[model samples]
Target: MLNNYPLLAKVESPSDLRKLPRQQLKPLADELRAYVLDCVSKTGGHLGSNLGTVELTVALHYVFNTPEDRLVWDVGHQTYPHKVLTGRRDRMLSLRQRGGISGFPRRDESEYDTFGTGHSSTSISAAHGMAMAAKLKGESRKAVAIIGDGAMTAGMAFEALNNAGIPHGGLMGDLLVILNDNDMSISPPVGALNKYLARLMSGNFYTAAREGAKSVLKNTPLYEFARRFEEHTKGMVGPGTIFEEFGFNYVGPVDGHDLESLIPLLENLRSRPGPQFLHVVTKKGQGYKLAEADPVKYHAASGKFDPAVGFVKAATPPKPTFTQVFGEWLCDMAEQDAKLVGITPAMREGSGMVEFHQRFPTRYYDVGIAEQHSVTFAAGLACEGLKPVVAIYSTFLQRAYDQMIHDVALQNLPVLFALDRAGLVGADGATHAGNYDIAFTRCIPNMAVLTPADEAECRTALTTGYQHTGPATVRYPRGAGVGAEMTKPLTAWPWGKGEMRRHSARPQTHGRGTPRIAVLAFGPLLYPALKAAEALDASVANMRFVKPLDLELVVELARTHDALVTVEDSCIMGGAGSAVTEALSAQGLTLPVLQLGLPDEYVEHGDPVKLMSLCGLDAAGIEKSIRERFLSAPLLRSVANE
Candidate 1:
């Protein structure tokens, strides 16, 4: 595969790429694009965004001294082309695999990856900081932020733009903010207006002349007319007037794929001073025909696929995902109650609100990439006596914690939080993992947290949370459960109560009076704990609620069993396990308690099954841990003697 692209094979790094003739860059970009498609077909990663950034990635590395001049990418999914050029070409095959390179950029992975990113709308602030740091250190290097049009929807990007445009205490960094406008709304087809104006704005002659004219015509009516005329001229052609007000020299909505246009424009902008904005037009899935037609379907390939034929649906449909269960529940609930409304923070597809949106268009709200706003907006709706359900990923909900506390929970409003992906997420790594929600949400007063075990239970949990009078959360894992039947009616489960799935059959006392063990599992880990209970003869309780936490069940199990073990999929510290331990402390019961969950460290990207096994949360691992902790050698012999 490497040999197929001879030009790309020769480029081990950007240093080697700089040695190539300027005429060879176009051929190299073509080869690079082909290689990305091939590699992604085999490995399965971000497809559309990476395909869109090929030429831009090539031109940036060619024009700027990258490692020294920092290039920070927002939402690093589109950095596949950047990875290939920055000496990570061979590692493309190992993308998102265990013990391999990450799908997103990592600070520890490469020096060229100046900042790590996965969540959107952070590049502007980070790049401006780098530029200011370079200026403070007296370093002559540029700092560039390559942000997408979708990322620009967040308010944080504008906050950084508002600050970066002005000089900080008479000191400004050499910064460039490249808005990769792929939406195609503001930008029409590129023509003479785009190319000529982009080149003109980047030139030193125009910069000097504009400054000279202002200096000579100051305190005169002509100067005011000239300023308005310039702003209006740029405004009529493109969205440049807004950035000009932010104190940056605004350039054209140029064609990003045109290396000839991008290279010279970048070369000129690199030499310019203060802050500058370059609007480059690109398209998601630019080179691939199928992906270009439907970018959403091809956003990220799930598994290996034939590049020629593209992705094919399995003949036998797969089991419904957790998101699908939630979507169906939302529609069913909405049909029953007219006041029920569904909301998501730009994750309508990922959160499984498409069907709900189609059926109840008036009740479904897709707030654009604004998590904080979504929470407060839901609060406002709840205040009007309308039940608002926020279906969001657990990681993204972290961005709206304060809003959840002050706006919803503090006011004692009736808002339900349907948190999906509430555990270790594979491939996306620690940045996207929903490991801390349980720990964080349980601490707040008036917040009830529910951990459902299976698909059927997840639906019931949604109903339970929705029917509650105060703020409540129903968190479930990312993928499907253990094929549990979903035939039950949409109704709430008994409030804060847990059911015993399996009980130890052996006698309570043996020859040496060995104490019996009981396992309290919260969430999907209940399934694995059940398997482990078979081997250890331990009683398993599917602890449904993490907050109210079935205290009666805890005391009953504690009094009956000799040792207690708490299990969850969240962090071990300050998680459901900590809740159980705290309840025991409040009851003044002293017993052998073992806490099992995610370790106090960041788990990397890999297969979810393997990651769970590594964390000692699998069936075999759970059995081994229980035996080692409670059923020691002498106690095991005593039990076997019976």
Candidate 2:
């Protein structure tokens, strides 16, 4: 069944795949799925969803003339097969590795990646834009968006569909949207709409009756009348009742894993016109037995492991990640304070709030994939004098920027934002990196931002944020911290002040400056900064607060030190570095300042160490950059002296 396909290995591009015989497509799909499983088993990535979409990706690429025909993938976690087929198979081994291929569709990476996607439910809007652009240029190229059923729950997806349904300047363009329904998000999708859609799609009688009526109606003399009757019948019986109202020609609940079904259906849709929606049913981890049995656990993975026993849990010294620390602290805080509530936008496990949800059922809210709602919900809770702790990823929180500014910050609500995965997140790539929170949060009027370098600091920061009356965010990175001993209950640290790890003694400038070159480090990057400082014989301060500026420390460092360097695992632009710059400007202290952090460009996926090095956030990289900047200072001083 898998023989006689020259296009399988010969294909260097999507165009090459398009040249194959239609009958051989099934074999190609099989081969592609196998290849994906092999690569993921070795490298470890988003396995389940990609396994499910192998046939769908093949079918779309085969039918569509990509590059010209824009295909925007929603969420992009499932784009492994798409990447492999689109002239990136050679680099598949290096998937999610630093300075290698990204896990998501990056516009800068290739022409095939028409739109960069990391967050969910964006494909339709992006594709709509592309379609509109094509129409404006008088270009006949097709624009297709492949989004998951899970992503469909997001308000943005519906908003896009609503806009796409309207005629383009009163004229609708050719845009095909494929809904890949795997019946699950990272966790099983929640909400009434999800349940309603699942029932409508999975109900055997509903599907059979709809298809049977259509089949009989096509043969009848009253076929047009029967089709209209069928549409009315569907409105009464079906749930995409809402989608029809959105002005889309809804097709299928079709078998997505079946290429025979998908290819013909895609071809038929391709021939037709105006905003097409195909609801294709697929299982996450369709081919892989182990993953199919347990989709959520295997949604995404890391490192090499045996397929037989499944992913082996690596044996290590017992130490909690910053996420786990936050989760424990949140639960403990909730136990102590009855008014404390928890909120997460579809990140139960990722944020480590599973136990909290179980223990405090009334207070915990999983607001689906709606980040905007999550923030506003927390704000509403805070309005009632209830402390709402929003446990969200730094990247995901970007979606709720307006809500954070307008609702939480403006109102000065006591909402504690537990920002997990705050720094360079390994494997998940640029989309998942929480690099901009420091800059974004600090800019807000009533917002206070704190970063925890170690596990203990994470717990303290959470307590500090919770105790604060205004909007506060405690940002921490992914993975294990420096394994600091977790001994006590939650305790609030001094607000807006920093802890000095080392004291200088050169002169009594601002404070005594004996050591010189005060290195202000924030978040998980502090470990490397400390190591670098030891090497350079410099003073170090765990500048815990991103906002409030640590005024006293800044003034002292500026007065005493010949040079000062600010280090953080966030974007240098408008980040922790920017915060320090703003603070120094306010003080009118212009001592040689070096801002070291993540660069302006997006950090790619790889091992955390490699990614840090690439962004100059590593110990060696940070020290070298600081050394180079200081080396240039002497020349400037000579010019000043002249």
For model 2, how does the per-residue alpha-carbon lDDT over 1-642 read when each residue is reduced to its tens digit?
124434467778898888888888888888888887777778888889999998899989998888888999999999998998899987888888777788899989889999999999999999999888888888888899999977887899999999998886766878988888898332232334443443454345555676687788787788888766656865543344567678776765666777766676677677655787777778989888888999889898767777667887668655778888888998899889999989999889999999999999999999889999999988888888888999999999999999999999998989989998887888887789888898889889999999888999888888988899899999988888889988677788898988888765443232223325778988877889888887777788889998877889887776667668899888888988777878877866666668898888866678887778877878999888877776434413212211
lDDT by residue (tens digit), candidate 1, 396-450 = 9999999999999999999999999999998889889999999999998999999
User: If scored against the real structure, what TM-score would every candidate get?
Assistant: 0.97, 0.88
Give each model's whole-structure lDDT: 0.91, 0.82
Q: Highest lDDT among the candidates is held by which one?
A: 1
Output the lDDT of residue 64, model 1: 93
Please list the residue runs of candidate 2 whose C-alpha ends up more than 4 Å from where it truly belongs after superposition.
1-7, 184-232, 236-238, 505-515, 631-642
Worst 10 residues of 2 by lDDT: 633-642
Top model number, TM-score: 1
Query: What stretches of model 1 exceed 4 Å from their correct place?
Result: 509-512, 633-642
